[model samples]
Target: MYLSTRIDKALFPTAALFFVYFLVMVWVNNSYAYFLHEYMGAAQKNVDFEFVSYLAILAAYCSFLCSSKIRTPGDLVVVLLILVLVPHALVLNGANSFAPEASPFSGVPLAVLLGVSLVGLSNKIHFYERDSGEDGRRYIVLLASINIAVLIFIVLKSLGHFSLDFSGQYIRRALARDVFAAGSPSGYIASIGTQAFFPVLFAWGVYKKSSFYFFLGLLNVLVLWGAFGQKYPFFVLVLIYLLMMYFRRHGQIKTAWLLFFAIGFLLLGVVEHEITDYSYINDYFVRRAFVVPSSLLGVADLFASNNVNNGYSDTLIGVLLGSERSDPLSFQMGVSIFNNPDLNANVNFLAISYLQLKYLGVLFEASFVGGVVVLLNYLYACRGSFLAIPVALLFATKILEQSLPTVMLGSGVSFMLLFLVLIAAPPQRRATGSPQQ
Candidate 1:
């Protein structure tokens, strides 16, 4: 059947059910995990709630995807409702059912789920084709130049042309070892280049309307993520900004203003550091700064723990990869990475990684591999929005995660962009005549 007929009968029920489930999960979660230990428990319990929400939202969106010629507004409504409720619900509930930490209860998965939802919703927007414009040759050349420079820097480091040291004293010696052991260069300029490249490329993608630029940005971000580890959110912000610019271009200034206000209020604590003890925002920013250095230091300190010829290096990686939740291992890893001869420092990168991956198995490949797949799937599926900012965002996450443990966080910027895209997407069969709006 047609778009109107199909959505009338099939989509609304699914949307209502999805909303009901989300509300219950957010409002009436009577379990201790949802109430008593909300903020105090490890971050994983909060993540578990998000994983459930994604599954539900994903199913709801899939039904929309199946509808024949789904109307643009219908798609917009479904996606917006999910994006608003799921992540914000988690944020509002916080650690103590309604704990008061900055950016509370919610994290990256929520941001990513919402980002993906926005792109999916945007696919239904009718993009009016432009009269054949100049081919995107100049854009491709510029991006290639940028990628080559970064690649060259990576090669030089691998060959030891310069000592790659970005870990300043903010971290302990042992923790530094873990950072070094991961062994990718943390060079000051290189680090910035890796992080900055995605946004630059994303803006190009939008201006040129080039799919090649889009995928290139996506692939580069993933590779950077794999090389870096855990600090992918910075690059995601770049993508979100690109989308914001797009919305503004499409005459969605009012929508953008509302999003800025909401995110500002939601992440106010994080922005201001109001809640220090067990704060998710603090934990994310502080721990990330230390993780790279601590990991490098942990690698070096492996020798201190035991004699040579006994597989010290392998032991360090094993320690890094194994016994994740073991409290003792956590302490030891920290001391090694931070070079805490006095044993006061707490470098538990691997312990955190392991604890999160314990039930999944030692490989912990889901965060690495499956996360990439989820991001790439979103990018390719919405190819129509090749120049779209949210798509660039989808690419950046996968790209950053490739080298870094760029687990999606409820990024302030991404959430803002989701709101913008949801609002910018045109009503059914409608089209803005010019890029100038």
Candidate 2:
């Protein structure tokens, strides 16, 4: 019975639905002007009408076989109604709303409903582990080999012929720009800070243990604050916490002296003068002190525009795609999703999340087709790091961006494709290497 049960695919229908949604989304994108002006825009009469239609359609077509059974049919109906209605209300009324043009609650509400329904279905469809055999070992070896090759290339580049300017002048200019308000100080700091972030992330991946992830996460936050000295650190801190929790679940790490360091660093920033720049260290902090306020202000300005612009536009996405760039916060967010070879910029996970919402309209994308794409991305990519990528994406989306199919496909498609191989590969049984936990 167990074997027979396991033989049935858990998410075949969900997978199919997601592919169809993806195709539809692509079609919609190509013909966006029509749908946006005709159906969605025109449906704005009586604000609640759009939501009502969505609920009615979901009820009419979707089967509730995946949802939980309640004590009575009436209770079941009530649960279903709440699952559908509550998210809609929250989205329309809650902080999630961005543009006045689109119903304020629309995106969030749909996100909640879709999330609930999918979760219910996932619960019904238990994801069991299969014996991957020698193929699994081979996959891990292949992954590790690829990582090693990349690392070797970096090492060779750094040690063999690399002659980077390694200039602190950029930092000085950034500070002057802030002091004079000539350009965005936050942008400079964020740009430099983002340059620093990859090392920290790579450290976490190599460490591959929970404690290392925690330590690296805290380290990244501290460095971000020390270097940038603004609200931008908050995103990195949040991401670190998420990574910490994720690793902790795997028993990869424990809260230890690392957490202590983070707390101490944060405190130092609040009280100690010029702590963020650490100019005292070698004039770096002193220089950053001049730039910190401007950089911080720029980050604040971007958020303030949420009220002014009504919705995020191409500006933010362009930043990610390296077509246009902004101050540090925007640069970091943009760099995270799309790797800019021209700038020698790598992807930053935290930045990717923020841009998703900033450019894509978060709740709307997540609750519907976008959510499934993320799920499939998980199934296909980041095999060894399954929950991490999507969780990071969702986290980024929640605070900074929204999920858009085209955005995901256009910029991140290749990386996502590579990640799928990782997920399909099996875990190592011998567990050859361990971090310094």
Candidate 3:
């Protein structure tokens, strides 16, 4: 019976879903590679076909592991599989031009292995579950109000510099940097508001079927985009809404649909690029989102080999350890690799960990991240809260460009975890609402 159950779980809908997802990902990967080589003249070298086949086999096995473990749309393993591991797999598939000198064999497989291990190990180690029984709605509303107030103050403070013109986004982004410099109160507030408070409020609104809170959350997203000139909030808000609606209707998260949407959007961008001779979507969404983060694994690995490891000096733990400081890691990477001092070549956490302590750092970071995933999954399982989806999604995206410590603390995920804990309702509430209602 145990063996039968394992086979059933591994081969049925879950495995089939990921199989389709993987196929779409491969198409997306090949399409992007062709775009880079043909249109951009990047002269990207394709890895051995045998090597690509090997990576595909590995990815298939990892997908099986992930399929067996995924319990919800909000699962950390889901994000790791889709956002982290898929990109790395694609990188090995003739997409390594971002670091020509760096070995494609190194850094990426380690990251993939760690990701698969996390998927396998998740829910294996159990944690104590507790519910506060507090009024989740009340606390969520209070938090939203406070974040809204803070956002208003930020906008008022920068009223003179504010410009909503999309074309002037770069200038406004620079202004935002000056206004909300790192470690400043405004910076922290913006992170918390955007990453935690607003997302939760928006999700809660969806749950309660409250149009007021729903549109209010969207209005805040616009305010944030106008004030900070950051475009992620708009995209993330839309994604959260869609995921929430899907979950509500299906009563389960379907990984295949997510992949279908991703592939659809990607192909749309590619078609637009082909027709108009424009590459903004290709550059920003395709290259920046997937290719760069994956290629940075090799770049970070190569950089770490020749230089002194950061010894956690780039994080809060480094400050506590009194480690000596230099230019930020992203800036250093930007200057060294891209020859651009102004660029911030931020990368995924695995690469950042490798930069800090090489292979051992990767292991430690993976373990830490896996533990956090388990904790978040525990909370979600106990409460079955839709709000966890957005928070987890935010953390997943942040990790694509930030270090683990920065994603957890600076990006306000730790605070969001606390918020999840505070707002966790009884398991009984999970079945209270129908999707149609």
Candidate 4:
């Protein structure tokens, strides 16, 4: 009886979250299928909505089981999976009609289920004892200072002639793209500063109630935005602030609230579009942000199903094996689907995995990603620092769009993990034996 009661307690919040999430998915799926399809030329197939609804429900159930508890990083990943991956999975089912050879049903659902289960199981495994110690604030400051120095150097070298011009954002973005073209070292440094270092500084500021550091971090974000003409830094800043504020008040991050706010924002966009016929919100948020990316998965599946798998040739493993180089799978997919060689249709990790090794690739990628989530959970548990929450959230967003290897190595999430560890490390003893500040 006691065990059953505990199970019920664990499941109650999960059930409520699942209900709201399901409704949101249904609404969004319908919008994608009909409203956006007709209005914005969004991709869709003639697949039956009833069949897609059933698949979504099954995926949602798997998500619910994975999200039975939400106190850990793994649980948070499941929430993201529910929001991003499940929707993509539904789109894939419809896309299968467009690419029957891909047979998305053969592996997508099983991959998601396995991924969620592994993450949940790994989250429950405790690898380290909690250290009841002061946070490594000094180290964070040191890291932030180093990041600032690096940013200054990069700006002086690469962006010396550029000035902030929000009014001409597209022009500025084109210039920024030229400045930070692929394989540029300064580009990588700038990415690390904005995506990893500054966010951590800002989160630390919020955790310590330091308004000066908070503003400092925010100013750096604006500077990076102006310099790079990238909007994601601002988005990351807002997301981190919201997460920090929520965690401060509630003592835990609630997935339901995240979903609720997201749905509410989308609903407001829908209303705005209906009232004013202004399609900015619908175009950017609904179509560009979610629908376009989700639709690309179908395109990727089609390309991968009909062609030879890349066999990991686009990654470092290929370099180690001396495999012949080829255009990245994203660029290849873009060329195949849209006949645009310059276009890159980067999809989520699952689609990327399938492109690399077919169904078996999905299983390996799922397990690997699950392991990464476990490591993040372990780091958060050991540190007990609220700052880690925002960092983890940033990393989670990366998973939604990029493959695990790219997110970790190329996008500086590995550096974020390193920062978490450094911030949790023990401080050195003073030579003078004075009381430590």
Candidate 5:
């Protein structure tokens, strides 16, 4: 049953308070252990400034989310970020492998916070859902044709015989390695299309009780999620599905569903480790998958090293403008390559923010990101824009978790192009001031 009291409204504020409590406790005990402090230097100013900046971004995001009445995908995005970040903050065991005095959070916390909050604002329009009238024999043939075609292509490409490693390890470290070579056109198609709202459309099919669409959608999610070997996005997809189901039906985010999802996630992790080895799980899951805080710290160190490029990296903007294109990881992590080849190359979007503009520039980029989302809400609005939610969610993830500039330059910009595919008129056409159809 839908509760009259919206618990989600409290989520942002509550999370903010949770972090505050942790901070207070850490300070009081004189044992504040966060890897960010370790990497940015053990000095008080490094951690203090970074923590203050983080608090400001959190306040801004919570303010925006709390202002809105209905639940949006931003709610889940914010929570997922906290889940990724806070635990990393709490656990600190060793000295940083990178710089001991690098304060990355001072520049980046806002990037992620506002990046996600913008997704919520960008989807203020209602979902423009329509009834798909009948599932005739022709409909079955149409769905099956594309579904089978895509699935077969994916299966063949993944096989050992094909020898095409689209497995995302290329962006990990050095690019010169033989394993880092590029893949076929179909590989690029699958990678780019995966982050769009393909699964949401399929889920709509499942909601319509089309078994063909359901299985196709399910396999699409599996392959896309497994491509990276990180399960965070996999479960994030599930969370998206749950939110879509709830919002489409106008219901509360159930406690039971969250519990079930958490348990299932834990079970999957355990099962994988049990089948494999702890070394594999720790290296991939703990170290690489949870690389944000440490990677951000390293980027902060890069800033301190005075390795700033004179101009914008010239990659993301070039790609976005149709001039030059490159992979997000390689392009963003170019500076860090010489410092340490094996260093985490997935330095996140903030690295681009820093490389382009350095410290104060991070703020400009964060504001630019947040403002762009708000502008997107304005540009893409419709009377009932169903497609906006999942697409915005994808965009938010790209900005927050991936390289910010490259995404804005590459797949992120391409997502907006969907308007041409999905809309017959300009977004302004269906707006309220315009004549209603």
Candidate 6:
């Protein structure tokens, strides 16, 4: 006798359905009026609604496959991007529109539809959940030691430059320099603290409902995001915990929901401190959030203006030192010429990859993204636990704005990530709200 898994049987039909949906969205799509609106007496659209709606449906489907658990900082990123961020971007992008009308065919609908299909390929997958135990003492020690040392350094640095001001001075000062060096305070936080420590600890705190880990996670946020004037570190973590308590209440105490309000109240304080001017929302949501979509302009411009540089030299720099890490003369010239700073914000992974390797770069970038979905799905297939979802989200987060090369090569990211993922507790027998012992 032969047996087949649910995924095996459903794969073809799902793929066919995805293809048909793509066609329908593309064929029956809206005209210029659909994606854009009149603003300031001009027709301008920032986001494509058809795209956002399509992605939401797909994300909902993907969430259903993952058992609909949203319990990690990483999960928040994916969910918020699909639910809150993208939609917000769509609405706000139109706020500044000066165009007369929308385009005949919008890539927003097609791109998101395609993205949904690609994301769905990871459905029905699973991973092994390695349990936390006494055997991991050395690993705990390793993390603790690093955390302590960095904490001390960050404190000293803060004291050396302490002030009661929140006039964007601190943030402006900090962001002015390269913060990715091992010796620099931010390099440790952004690269290591944010990547390795915060996610792992925050996940543990929410999973176990332990104050020790919870506060510890906040400390990580303090040095990396909070002190730097970035609120996302704190925001993403608290959001994940609240969401978990609401969605999966097994280990959670009845009073845990209080933490949600507490975090929110505190977050509002931080937001007030960070706002510099009247354009805060425009700066944060319109300019910052929509970078990924607006980034398509950079890619298009690069391809339109320049002959392919063949990318041989830049690719080497990208892999070894991350993007423009060494900043060789040739690399500097190339960035200025091809990946022009003319764009208001950071470019997306697609633009970075194309700048480095042209069409071949896009292929590599797609494959890596696809691989992430596959690996995460495979883990889910094996374990079917909550842990699998966040870990996958964490890995995917690295690719959202940065190129794969930057993510892979920067900091001690690869080694530290291995430690974080390997040390996670194994999945419980069933995927449910009950706390893990």
Top-TM-score structure, candidate number: 4
Candidates sorted by TM-score, best first: 4, 3, 5, 6, 2, 1
Residue lDDT tens for model 6, 1-437? 11112433333443334334332222211211222212112123433577556445553453333222333333333433333222222222222232112221232222332343343333323333333333333465567567767766655555544333557645634643333443455664646644555655566566667677678777776665433555555555765566555645553222223323333433443354357423343334333434223333323333324444435344465446454434422234335544543232333454455555655555565566555554444343333334444455455555555556655655344554466457544544544342221
Which one wins on lDDT?
4
Q: Rate the local accuracy (lDDT) of all candidates.
A: 0.36, 0.33, 0.63, 0.64, 0.44, 0.43
Candidate 2 total steric clashes: 33
lDDT measured at residue 365 in model 3 versus the true structure, 0 to 100? 79
How well is each residue in 1-437 modelled by candidate 1, as lDDT tens digits? 11122253545555545444443433322321132222322121243665566546654654454332212222322333333433332322232311223242123223333333443444433333323233334444754576658756654543422222335223323343444342245443344344445554555665556566566666555444334432354436553555445554662322223334434433442444445434453344322322222222223233223322211122234456563332233344345444455443222222123233232321343234333333332322222223233333443343222211322222122332342334332223322353211
Q: How high a TM-score does candidate 3 get? A: 0.83
Model 4: lDDT of residue 268: 74
- Model 6 stretches with alpha carbons more than 4 Å out: 1-43, 46-116, 124-141, 157-159, 162-164, 169-190, 225-227, 250-283, 291-344, 377-389, 411-413, 424-437
lDDT of each residue in 1-437, candidate 4, tens digit only: 00011232435555555556555545654553335643322444444566556655664555445544356665666677666676565433443334433343555444544555555555455434355466666677777787778677657765653556677666666676677765577767767766767777887778678887798788777777667666667777887788777666766676667767777866777678678876566665666556666566667656755788788888877777898867778888878877888677877777677778776787788777777766776566555554556667777788777777777777788887776776665433223332111
Local accuracy of candidate 3 as per-residue lDDT tens digits, 113-202: 564465445534433333335446667667777877877877887786787788977888888888888778888887776666677678
My TM-score estimates for the predictions, one after another, are: 0.32, 0.34, 0.83, 0.84, 0.59, 0.59
Which parts of model 4 are misplaced by more than 4 Å? 1-13, 16-20, 26-41, 44-56, 59-63, 66-69, 91-104, 107-113, 126-129, 160-163, 383-385, 426-437
lDDT rank, highest first? 4, 3, 5, 6, 1, 2
Off by over 4 Å in 2: 1-127, 131-214, 226-417, 420-437
In model 4, pairs of residues that clash are none
Residue 312 of model 5, lDDT score:
49
Q: Candidate 1 has what TM-score? A: 0.32
Q: Which lDDT value does model 2 have at 123? A: 26
- Can you give the lDDT of residue 265 in candidate 5? 45
lDDT of 3 at 143: 76
Off-target runs (Cα >4 Å) in candidate 1 are: 1-11, 20-85, 88-92, 97-129, 135-137, 155-227, 231-385, 389-437
Evaluation by TM-score, superior candidate among 4 and 5: 4
